[model samples]
Target: MGVCPECRAATYQMRQGKLREEDCLRCGWLAIVGADGTCRCCRAAVRLGEDPAWLRAVLERRLLPAGRPLQLALRMDGLRLKTLPLRQTRPLTTVKLPSWARGRPAELQDDPCVCVTEVPGQLGLFAPCPRSFTREHGTRIRGRTPVEWPIVLAELKAIAAERGVGETWLVHTGDGARLALASRPPTERLVSPEALVDLPQMRPTVQLVLQRAGLLARPRPRLVPGWWSKGRGSCRDCLAWTNGNDQRCRDCQMWGHTHADGPCHRCGRGLPLRDGHCRRCLLLLAETEYDLDHIALEGGDQLWFGGPYAPHLKTTTNRAGEQTGLYGRRRLQTKRRIAVQTSRATAHTVSEHLAIPGQLLLFHALRDWSRLDGRPLPALTPNAEALLADFTSHIRARGWTLPGNQASLSALKFLVAHLGADAPFHETDVRLLAHHPNFAAPRVINYLRAIGLLVPDEKSDALLATARRYADEAPAAFQDGVHRWIDVMCNAGTRPSLPLAPSTVHGYVRRARTCLNIWHTVGIDDLRAITADHITTVLDTLTGETRKTTATAVRSLFRALKREKLIFRDPTRGITLTVAIPLPKALPDERLVGALDLLPFARDKLSLTLAAVHALGVHDQRGLLLDDLDRARGRLTVRRAGRLDRTIYLDELTHQLIKKWLAERHRRWPSSTNPHLLVTARTSADDNHPKVHPRAISKPLSRIGLQPGRLRMDRILDEATHTEDPVHLIRLFGLSPITAMRYVRAAHPDRYRPLPIAP
Candidate 1:
C-alpha cells in the first residue's frame, strides 16, 4: 500500500483473502458492509478494488436520499476522507441497499470511533440504527417529516456504498468551523462500467448530454507534428532545437537569422549579395553611373568613365584573370563615344555657324534643318546663314508679292525649298518683279513673259508698256494690271455694237474698242483693229427683230445717223430729207411715243410728233382727208375722159371733205389710225387694192410734179416750208417730217423763200 503524501498515513489495501474487503489494520481503520460490501471509515465508505461484476452491482443501487437530509462520506486510510451531503438542501429518504451488500457483516465496533462534528447552521449529521433502518422502516421513512434519523443514516450509507466508499467513516467539522473532516481518506470510486468498457461509447453519450445543456467543450485544434509547432518549437530565426520550447535561439535572438555576406556601400548595412554586389550598392552604382554619364553627355562636351584619365575608376586588381580584349569592346564603346562627341561638336558648330543668336542648334536641327537636309548635317557658314536669314526675312516681309527677278526669285525659290518645301509662289512675286527698285520693269516683265506668268493683251499691253518705259522709275505694272484686269472683267459687260442688246453688250464693246484704239494709237499693231471685226460680226449675226424688222429698224438707224451727223442723202440717186432729230424723237413710232409721254414734251416742240400721230392714225379725219383726195382725183380722171388728172382736191378743203378723204384713205393704209392720205402704186396682181409701203408713201409727194418740178412738186416743195395749219399738213402726206416739210414749203413759198426778205 502506498502512503498518502499529504496526510502521512498508511494507505489501506484490498484483502485478497476476503471478498470485496479493504482494511487499514495499523490505523485501526475498519469498514464493513452496512449496506454495501465495502469497508467504511469515519462515516464514509470505500470500495476495495472492484471488477465488472461488483461495479455493476454497486451502480444498480438507489443511493441518494429521496426527501430527507442525508450525508455521504468517502475515506481512504492514508488520505483525508471527503464528506458531502447527498441532498444538499433537502431531507434524505431511505434507499434500497445493493444486493452485493445484503449478506455482509458489519465491523463498526472494532474500527476506531470517528468523531461526528456538526457543521454550523443548516448542515446536520445523522446516525443509522441497524434495527430502525429495516426495509419496512425505509418505506415508512419516505412519508416522515424532517426525516427519520435512522432512515437518513441508512440512506447516507447507501450513497457511500454506491460510490464504492465504505459507510464506516464519520463526518465532522474542523475546530474553527472553516472545514469539515472525515476520519479516513476516501477510497477510489468506481468509474462507470460503460466508461471502462469503451471510452468512444461513453464519450458520445457524455457529449450529447453536455451539448443539450449548452456546456459542450470546444474542440481542440488538430495538430500535425513537424508541420507546425503546438507550443513546441523555437522561432524561425533561431537555429536551435525547440522540442517543447517557446523562446527564440540565444545565438540569433530574432525570429529569422539567415546570414548574408556583403554590406551596402552607401548605408554600411549588410544586404543580400547578388551577382557580386549588394543590392543597395548595385542600385547606387547604377544610378551614379547613369547620372555621371548623363551629365557628361549633356551640353557640348565628351567624357569617359571607368577608364584611364577618367575621374572615377572601377577595377578588380587581386584577381589576375584575363583582361577582356579592348579591340572589339573599344570599337563599340568608341562608336558610342564618337556619336556623343559628334553630336556635341555638331551642336557647337551650328551655334558658331548660324547667324541668329540665342537659338539652340539642336532645336533648329529638329525644327528646320532636318526638314531641309532630310537629316541634320554640318552647319552652314556665317555668310550662308546671313543669306538664309535675310532671304527668309524678305519672304515673310513681302509675302507672295516678292519679285520674280532672276537673282531674287531664284534665291527665294532655293530658300523656300530649303525652309518650307510645300509653300506656293504667291502673286507678290509678280508684283515684286514689276516694282522692285534694283531691277528694271522691262527686264522683270520680260522674265515674267518668258515664264508665261504675264500675258499682255490689248487691255494690259498699254499699261504694261507704260510700266516698262517707266520701268525702275514707276510703281509695279503687275499690280496695276491686277487692278485694271479686275475693273475690266468686273465692269465691262455691255456695248451697243455687240450682238446683245445695246444696254447689255454696250459696255463690253466700248471697253474693247477703247483698249483697241489706245493700243493702235500707241503703235501696238497686234492690238489694233481687234475689236472692229468683233463689233461688225456681232451686228451681222444678230437674228431677231434687229435683223428682220428692216422698216422699223431703218427708221431708228436713220434717226441715229442723223443725230450722229453720219447721214448723207444726195437726192441725185434718191430724194433726200435732212433733219436734226432730238433723242426723244429718235426712236420708231412706238418707242418715240413712249419717250414723248415719258419725257412730258409739248406737242409744238416735237419734231416727229405729227409723224407719230399720223402713222398711228388715232383720228378719223386723217383717213377722211385721204379718201376725199382719192375721190376728187377719180372725178377729174372721169371729167378729162380717162386722161390722168394732175389736180386733185382743193388746197384748202372743208372739214367734212377732209374728213371723208381721210376716212377713204384710212381703208388703204392697214395701220392708218390717224387722219392722213398718200398714194401708193398698186401691182397688177392686186388691182382691187393698193400695195403701199409706209416708207414709199412720202416718195410720190416729194415727186408730185411735171416740168422738172410740176404742180405736185410745186405744191409741196419749198426750202423754208410753212403752213397755216401745221396739224392739217400732219394729216396730209401721213404728216411725216419729210413729206410735211415739202408740202408746207410748197404752200407757203413766201415764208420758206430763201430767208432773204431781210435784204
Candidate 2:
C-alpha cells in the first residue's frame, strides 16, 4: 500500500483487508513466512514503484540456467533499471519514477554574465539570492541566480550602464537582486552576489571590487562639530554641550552628519548617552519586561564558552532558564550546554554565547582591561574566550585553557576585583585576595604567572602564613627564643651546614609548645622556673614515641634558651631515657593485593606503586620532575636535599606505569607549563615548576585505604628482611647508617635481643 520508511521498498501493509499483515510499521520487513524469508534486494537498496510480479517475471527470464543470482539497481535520477552479473554492466529497462510529494524547484543556475558578491559586514552570510537553513545554524550561504533572471538582467544592465561599472562583479548584481528579490515570489534561498564572495563568482578575488572600481559608494570618515572631545562642561554660549554649538552645529544637524550631537538622547544632558539612557528608561523597560514571562531574543542561538575573568554573573535568567519576570511561568524547552562548537565564530556570533546584560557589562570590562593594560589579547579560544566569558561576550581573552575547572571562573573574578590602577600586580598584592573563602586565586595566579603578568612570589604565602601562625602560638616570655630558633631552623639568616624542613621545625615547636602549655596550666611557665624535676614529671606523663619526641623537643628548647642567655641551666639535660626502636610491619597480604588495580587515575597508580614497591617518601614523590624519569634508560633519579642522591633502574612495571601516567597527564593537561612530572588541575597552569604538594601525592592513597608512610616503611622493611645485611640496606636505599641499623635490628631481632623481660 505504501513505501517502507526503512529499506524504502514497495510492500503490502494489510492482509485480507482485515488485519495488519505484511510486516511491522517501523521496518516493513517480513523476511519470511513459513519457508521463504530471505530478501536480498531489501538489504542492498530500496526497490520502489516496481510491481512484484513484473520484477519476478523479468528475473526468471534473465536467468540463463539454474545458476547464480544477478545484482539489480535502479538509477533514480535517470529512471533506468540495470543489472550486473560477473563483469558486464547494462541497462535492463527504462521506467518512470513515481512519488506522491512535489519535488523541490530546480536550483538556481550561475550566470557568468551577472556579478556575484558578499554583504559587506555580515560573515558566513552572503548577499542572497540566500534563504536561512535553520534558526540555529551559523552563517553559511547558498548562492545561485534568481528565477526572474530576464527582468533582473535588464535592470542590472541599466544600472551597470548608469553606474559605469562592469557586469562581472556580484555587488552590482546584489543591487539588482535587492531591487527585485521581494517582487519575485518567495521560493528557495539562492543568494546572488553583487556581493560575489556570497556567489563566490571570482574573476577571481578582489576585496571591495565594485566600490574600488567606483561603481558604488565607499565609506569615508565622518567630520563632526567637535571631532575631538577637547573640553568638558556645559557651555555658557549656547547653553548646551559645546560653546561653539552656534552656527556649525545647526548646519551639521541639518545635514545629519551631526557630530553636532545634542542633549540626552533620553535625558537632555550633553552626555552622548546620558547615564546610558538613565534609570528612568531602565525602569520603564523593566516595567514592560516584567509583564512578559518569556522574551525571545530574535533568531538567537545560544552557545557557551570558557574563559578566565571575574566570573560573577548578573542573571537575566536563572539556571533553570526562566527569565526574571514578575508574572508568567513560561519556560523554554532547550537548555544551555557548554558549547563544543569552537569552530571559528564571528564577532556577532560570539556575543550570542552569554546572557544579554552580561554581554553588555562584560565588554566594557574587557575594553578597560585591554586599554588600561596596554596589551591587546592574542587569539581567544580553547582558553581566553571561556575565561572571560563571565567577563566579555565580545572581545576574548587569549591564553591557555582557563587555569582551573569550576573554581577558575571565580578566580578571575577575584583578580579583577583586586586589579589596581596598574594591572598585572605582584604576588604580594594578590595575597589579600587569596584569603577569601569563596575566591580561589591560586589557579589564576598560576595562569597569570605563566603569561608573565604577575611577578613570582619571593617566598610562598602559604609557607610564610604557616610559620607566622606557629610563632604566634609560642609562650609570651619564650616567644623571643622561639622566633630565633624558628629563624635558624628555616635557614632565614645565617647558614648552617643543614637546615630543618618546615615540617620538622613545626614538629619541634609543636612538641615544645605542648610541654610549655602544660607547664603554664600548672603555673610553672617561665623557662627559668622549669626545673629538672618538672621535666621528669612531664616526661613521666608521656609514653613511647610521644615521650621520646617530646624529650627531644624540650632539650632543643632549653639548649636554644641557654645559648641565647635567656635561661641559666638546661632542665632537660641529663634527662635522657632509652626508647625501643619501632619495627616496620609489612602491610597485610590481603590489603596490598590488587590495591594499585583499584586506583582510578594512572598518576595515582604510579604514585602508590613507587611508594609500595620502590619506597619513595611523600616529599620525594612530589619533587620528581618530568626530566628525572629516564624511560629509555629505565632509570629514575631521586633528588634529596636539592641534590640527586640515587638512580632507580631496572624495572618493567615502573616503566609501564610511567608511560601510562605520562600519557594520561598530557591528555588531561595538554597545555600545562609545569615542569614537574605530577600535575593536577591546580599546578598545571604555572611555568614556575612548583613541586606537587606533599598532601596531593598522599591524599589519593589515603582515600583508597592506603598510607604512603606505612606503605613506604613496609617496602624498606621487606627489603631488609630479604637482604638481612645493614650495609646492603644502607647502600640500596640510600639510608643513613643509623637508620639502616635500626631497620636491620627490626628485621633480625634474633641477633639483637630486646631488653630482658622482668619475669
Candidate 3:
C-alpha cells in the first residue's frame, strides 16, 4: 500500500478504486466520490469507478496514490469517456471459496456479497452501490460498462497493415466481461508489406531500407557494340561487308578476314577467298577495297613464291601474255629459264664454285641451312676453285697479267696443297705471293718445293741434278736458278725434286777456284785433276820452304796462298816433310878463364892450385871448406839432375872440393856468425849464429860464374888451363873424352888443335 499524492495520508491498494470506509490520510482530506469514478485530489481516473491510477501512484510512492473525485460537469458527461475494470470480476461462488482454490468445483456455497456496481446515465458516472440495492430498487438503473475505443482499434488495423498480417484480433473491456473484436478482417483486397509501406500511411519496407544504406542487389550486365561493328565497316582480309556478311557475324567476319590474308588468298594462289566465289566479296559488291591480287603481284610474289619454287599449286601465263591451261607445263618452262640464267651468271661472275652438296652437309651439321644462300662457300679440299677469287683479286691489285686457265689452276692447287689447312693464302702468305714475279705454274712449283712440299720423283730428280751442277756458283745467281727450278717442280706437282743445302752450296763455291787452280798447276785433266795424290803433290810443291828464302817466309807464303785460294790442302792428309839446312855453330872464347879469375874467392893452396885461380876467386870463405858440398855434388849427378851423362867432370869435382873445404872450415869456427862463411865453434843460446851449408857457397859461385855445370864447370876449366897440364886437368876434373875436348876447346881454342881427322 502507498499514500496518494492528492491525499498523502491515505494508504491505497493496487488495482482497487472505490472504498467504503477509508478516508484520505494526506492533509486529513476527505475522499469525494465523483460520478466519473476518479480521484479528485490526484486527478487520477479509474475503470468502473475504481481508482487504479490513484492506487498505482500510491503504491509506487510507498507503492501508489489514493483516489480523487472528478468535477461535477465531467462526471455528468462521463458517457463520452472510456473505461475498463481495474480487476477482473470473480464469480459469486468463487468469492466465497478459500484463497488456495483453483478452478470452479462442484461444492455449493451461499453467501451474500457486497459488490459495488457502476451506474451509467445521460451524465454517465461510476457510483459505488451494493449489487443488492441495485437489484431491489430497479428504478430503471443503467449499469457501468466498457466503451469501445475506436482510436485504439484504428491503430491496431494500422499495426496489422505494417506487419503484413491479414487480420488482427483485440480484447476490449465491457461492463460485465471482456469482449473480443476483430480490428480488421482478412480480405482479398489486402495489400503486401512492400506496397503498403510504400504508401504514405506506412513506413519503408526492409528491402527499401537496405537499398538506401547501400546494400542493394547487383545490377544485371548489359551488352555493348564493338568499335568496327559500331559503324559501317569491311573486313580487311576478305574485303567483305561486315554488316551484311551473310550469317557470319562480326567475329566470324574478322576470323574469315584473318584467314584470307594468308598466301593462298591471292588470285593465282588457288585458294578461294569465298566458299564458291572466285572474286573477293568486296569486288562483287562493287565497294572500294584494296586490289589484293594486284598489290600482291606487284610486290614481287612471283619472285618470292611463284615459278617452280612456289609452295602453292602453280599458276601460269603463256609467252603471248595469255593464261595457259596446263599450269605445270608453264611452270616447268619458267624453271628452265631460271636455271639457265643462274648457270650463266654463276659461270661468268663467280670465280669460286660453291659445292652445293658439301655446303648442304655443313649446313645440316650446323643446323643453319637457311644461311647457305648468302654465306660464303667453304673451301673443302686442295682445289683451284677456292683460290680463284683471291688470286684474281691479288693479280688485279698488283697489275700482273694472270696466266692461262690450266696454269693458274695448277699453281693454285700447288699452293693449296703446300699451305694445307693453315695455308698462307688464308693469311700473310697471300700478300707475299700476290705480287711475286712468277705467279704462274712453274713459279708455283718452285715455291712449293722451296717450302719442302712433297712432289713426284721425276721432277725432283731433274731439278736436283741441275741444282747440283750450279751448286758452286754465287748465292744470288744460284738461288735464282734454284727458285726457277722450284717453280717448275711446283708446276709439275711432285714430278721434279731439288736438293738445297746452304752450307754445302757455300762450301762448293769456296772450293771452285781452288780446284781449278789445282787442276791447272798439275797439268792434269779428267779424273786425275781431282785425285788426292795429285792434289797432295801440288800442296807439297806450293807449301815447301825453298833454299832461296827463310823457313818463316816459306810458311807465311803457304798460309797466304791457301787463304787466297791459290792452293788447296786436304785436312784428311796428315803427312809432314822434314827439311835440313846448315846453321852456324857457336864457338866458346878461350879468355873465359881470365874472366873467371877476376871474381872473389879464398886464397888457400887447394883453392888456388887444385881449385884453379879462377875457382879460388869464385868460392866464398865457407865455400872453400865444407864436406856437405861434396855430398851435394854427388847427389847432383846426371841421373838425378837430368844431365846428359852420369860421369862426374871438372865442374863436378870443383864443386865437391869446395864443399869439403867449407865443411871443415865451419867445424873449426863453430861460433862464426858470418852468413857467407861458417867458422869457429861456440855454444850460445842465441839465434843469430850462421848455419852455412855446402849450397851456400855453391849457389853463390854458380850465380857469379856462368859455368856450364852450375859453378863447377868454370872452376875445372880454369884450373886445368892455369896448370897447363891436360893430364892433371883430366885426372882432377874427371872429364869424358867428349867433355875433355869441349873443355880443351874452351880453355885453349887455338892451343887445342884437333888432331888431323883420320879419314
Model 2: per-residue Cα lDDT at residue 578:
78
lDDT of 3 by residue, 1-759 (tens): 222233322224221333322233222233432332223443334433345654464344332222234332243433444332222332122113232332223343222222222232233233212121211111111121223334334454455467566631222111111111110112212222222222211123322332333322344364334543455444333334433434423433443553343334334443234433233432322221223233334333222221132222233567997644322344344654565566655544332433332122222121222333333333335344444455565444433355533455444643453334232222223333334343444334333434443242232344345545554342432333233333333343223345334443333333433444455554653321244454455455554343222222223323333333434653323434455432212225553445445545432323333333232223233332232233543432222122332233335545555566566655544443344333323211112334444453345334545432333555666565676556665554445566665665667667766559522
The candidate with the higher lDDT, 1 or 3, is 3
TM-score on alpha carbons, each prediction: 0.13, 0.49, 0.14
Kindly report which residue stretches of model 2 are placed more than 4 angstroms away from their true locations once superposed.
Answer: 1-424, 434-440, 451-468, 471-475, 487-498, 642-644, 752-759
Please tell me which predicted candidate would have the highest TM-score against the true structure. 2
Candidate 2 lDDT, 400-502, residue by residue in tens: 4443344555546434433321235456545544555555566556566655567665775465456556768866866766787677666653445356766
Instruction: List the lowest-lDDT window of 10 residues for candidate 3.
Output: 175-184
Tell me the lDDT of model 3 at 161. Answer: 60
Better structure of 2 and 3 per TM-score:
2
Q: Candidate 1 residues 1-759, lDDT tens each?
A: 321121212222122111222332112223321223223332233232223333343355333321221124443567755422222222232444443333223421221222233343433233211111112211222222221234334444454456565423312100101011111112212122222112212234333333333333355364454434456653332123443354543333321233355664544555444344543234334334434345433333332221122221122223566422212233334555666667665574432222233333353121222233333334445544554465445434432244443455443333333333222222333344334343333323333343433435234434434423332332232233222322333343232331223332233322333333344454445311233333343345444544333222223323333333333531112312233332111222332333323422221112122223222221221222333345444421112223332232333223243444345444443442222243332221121233335334333223321111122233233312444665565444334565565455545656766546322
